[model samples]
Target: MQVYCTKQHANNGSNRFCTQCGEPLPLAVGQVIDNRYQIIRQLGQGGFGRTYLAEDKNQFHQTCVLKEFAPQVKEPQDLQKAKELFEREANVLKKLQHPQIPRFHTSLQVKLGNKDFFLLVQDYVDGDDYSQLLEQRQSHGKTFSEEEVTTLLRQILPVLSYIHSLDVVHRDISPDNLILRSSDHLPMLIDFGGVKQLPASQGFWFTKLAGNHTLLGKKGYAPEEQLRQGKVYLNSDLYSLAVTILVLLTGKEPQKLYDSYQGLWYWGKEINVSPQLEAVLKKMLAYKPSDRYQTAEQILKNLPLLTATKPPTTHLTKLKTMIVAPGRQRANALVSKFHNKTQAVAKSIPLPVWIRPFAVSLGGTALVVLTGAGTWAVVNAVIRSVTSITIPSISLPEIPQLPNPLGQPVSDKGTKDNTQIISRRQQLEIPEVFFIKMVDELFYTSKPELKGRSLTSKAEDTALRNEWYDVASNFLDKLEQANLSTATRQKLGNYRSQDYEIWRRQARAGQLGNYTISQLNKDTNEKFDRLFPGQQRGKLNQQTFGQIWYAIAADQVSKLKSSN
Candidate 1:
């Protein structure tokens, strides 16, 4: 039961003035105004008013928020004009009936001690605001994860859609205005002191209000037009929402997330997330009203996998579901097949007895054991199979149900397939000679039959190189298809531009020198050592050099077997 002065200094309930700053104190606690609502304590202070936690005595002591409309105007006509604006805006907000939004009760004016108090009554949501939640996380050296932010956006966008459909725009949409409700863990929109109806019939009445028209939003969060000219568009709230998300993600203020000099949000590069999500966020934070997403529905549509009607049945299905891009589906199918086999092997093995007791304690949904080949187990919580049974690792030879890269049957035979020959006149985009030359540098390994020789002659080298190309072509054909997700495609593109393309260019120009060790990733570095055990980088024969690059590409493509 306390009041605060204009300087936000707390004062005793009985004091009419601040003892420290000597400014007029706000409504004292225990003071019942309008004989129905009892003042409790100050909750917050804003540009237009001070919010108090109050009790609706008429409704069995239920808690509510009373927002005081304290405009700094003295003239009789101006005061009357402010009252009309407040009532008009409140009536518009009263039409909103969203569950996530606090229900607006009514506006009341009461005279207590030679002064007037205009109060807005709303449902008091009992939970921490996002700002407070962020503070708690920051104290522990953490911020809202990308997943949390996306979930928040998914929930809050619908509320925005509901309100915008009613032609109401929330001018202020910072993290402070949103509350994570304790009753249902849903984000609740709490403030409407700055809500404005956007119908053409309203004729921009907000501009006429005194002491609060330009004070609707916080700096850095609000877009330029809204802050500078007191003009707000449907997308203005979206800009503020993006800023709020950036703040939650980086735990930094809006000023730090954005670069005022460059007039762009530099936070995108700082955070590691999907490029698709970054693009959507960037568009929402666009400086121009027209450049931004005009409606929440538009943003939902453009969001990364948010509007998907159903989940993917398989890794291949997921890749095809996404928009087509070059090299998108290239390594996905190959990686999925390999990953599934390894996962099956990893799961089918028997668990140790020492860990068995710990696993069974986790409950029934812990581990689901699927027996036999071509099947996999899902690890839910802990692995606690009571019986000790050993399941041998399964080898899957052919996936007949799935189509091959070129619509041919996948052979049970290993990588070397001499019968699969490319017809030159088949109008194939891939040149057979390209693969032949790509692997030409690979010398033959020492065979038991060819005892003393460790390297193949020119003619023997040519035959082995051609055989290797046939296998490489299978991967190339899939990569050229148009069904990969943008992320997968971009990853493959980087491998080509930064690795494969550089090697190919050097080899083709006959200027291949010592390969750049610094440019090689960990996998490539290891593979290089295995291929040329005791040889220096610049001293390898052309055959071994070609084999190393091919192995590098194969290894990279195989790594994607686990990627979506």
Candidate 2:
């Protein structure tokens, strides 16, 4: 049998004191704390207290981390303050709810011999920390690539964003604090001991045993501002993360990667990475907090997509080559030359100008061939090509069966009828020009109220737009609640769904860009003008637009049902 002494050094069960430190050992192996958690082994020890790997007897012997808050303070006031800080950490952990963060179990006081000890329990993350992983890689003469680093950033930045949302700054963020989970290989942020809420005025408390307000982070990893003045911002974590990545990439300490005299990092030439990522890291590691990215979201938005080693040769390029030759004769000659060489090129010719407009309106759901002439074969081929082309930032909703306006019919077997109705009303062959006009009228309208009534301020305009968008969403929700055919429901579901919801929320929060808003306005105005013309346009707000579109859609659905 073995018992861990106060210094966490393993000693024989018969030893009364630590083998190395000579500190008196109290807790023994397999001893239960508070009749709930059974001590298994000591994981680590720090200036404040020790951390243990324990099993919760109450939770089917589940493994958990038990953090002891035994600050080495002699003064009664300092001890009380330490206890307060410990409790505050507990409270902060309780409020944090993120998949990448360790879950806080509970906090309790346990009597070990004559002393009462404070302990906090948290979920035990099962995996190696980045530091250990780096060491392992170093041992094998390997290091993390830029792609792996980017993946790590993507996994952990969201966790930082979540904590920052609650106005909490993780004072300590380094490779040691990030544990890669065995289940998903995603990094899990651990050790909330250095978490401090911003606006410093809101209850200033921390584990400052020396009473000097010294910085609370590992040396060589913490930024200058944090090390010197104990000052930290939301981006301080970003700086630490940059240092950590640099260390991982080079397999060297941060100090080795940086030149203290020049106050600049010398890691660019050391590793081969994309210029875009290099620029992002440089910005993140900026000395001034204001110079760094203001938020995690900003970093995410600016982070470049990983460039592939081999350049992608798209089919569109081949099609363009065949179509855009010197002259019509030359173009036809080039098409002939490649017609047999590349069957794909022959099949992917662009759709006729008239049919192209419909494709845009349907958001690439399905292409309907209205004309049954020689163009039918061309249209089918073009449809296949269009479907193959991946459109960025456009996700088509799943097409659902049209609902029966009448109540569902039950069969003799006491089961609801499973008959599926496909919506053909959408295929009602309106001219390409008429389709565009209808879309314009449905999305926007020129109203007398909006004619000269400009917003007083940007804030006011943003708020008003967000309010109107919500009204529009609510209107759609109401329509969805009504008894409509599955086809009608599916059609309605396609519009004002995910995209509108995201845009509205971002606009309300003032996170959306002016360019996006302008594009939306232009597209919507054209659609609304086509749907409701002149005096029938009514108010230009989202609510009125929503009502108008819904009315027109319901009328169309009614016509289809009556015709059937």
- Reference-based TM-score, model 2: 0.51
Q: Which pairs clash in model 1?
A: 328-484, 335-561, 336-561, 441-542, 441-543, 442-543
Off by over 4 Å in 1: 1-24, 195-215, 306-564
Worst 10 residues of 2 by lDDT: 325-334
lDDT of 2 by residue, 1-564 (tens): 455554447676656446686444544436688988887655666544568878798897777889876443346776576678778778888988776789999988765644446788999765567886676566446677665676567557777888888877787888889886532344789887873322323222344312225477778778888889887778988889888888888888887788889998885566557888889899999989899998887777676553343221111111110111000000000011121211111112233333343321145554222110010000000001111101112122110011111111221232322211111222221111112112222222322234323221123344433333333333334434443443233233123333344344434434333324344444444444554344232333222234334334433423432343
Query: Model 1, 382-479: lDDT tens per residue?
Result: 11122111111111110111111221112333323333433320223222222222222221122223222221113434443344445445444533
How large an RMSD does model 1 have?
25.9
Among the numbered candidates, top lDDT falls to: 1
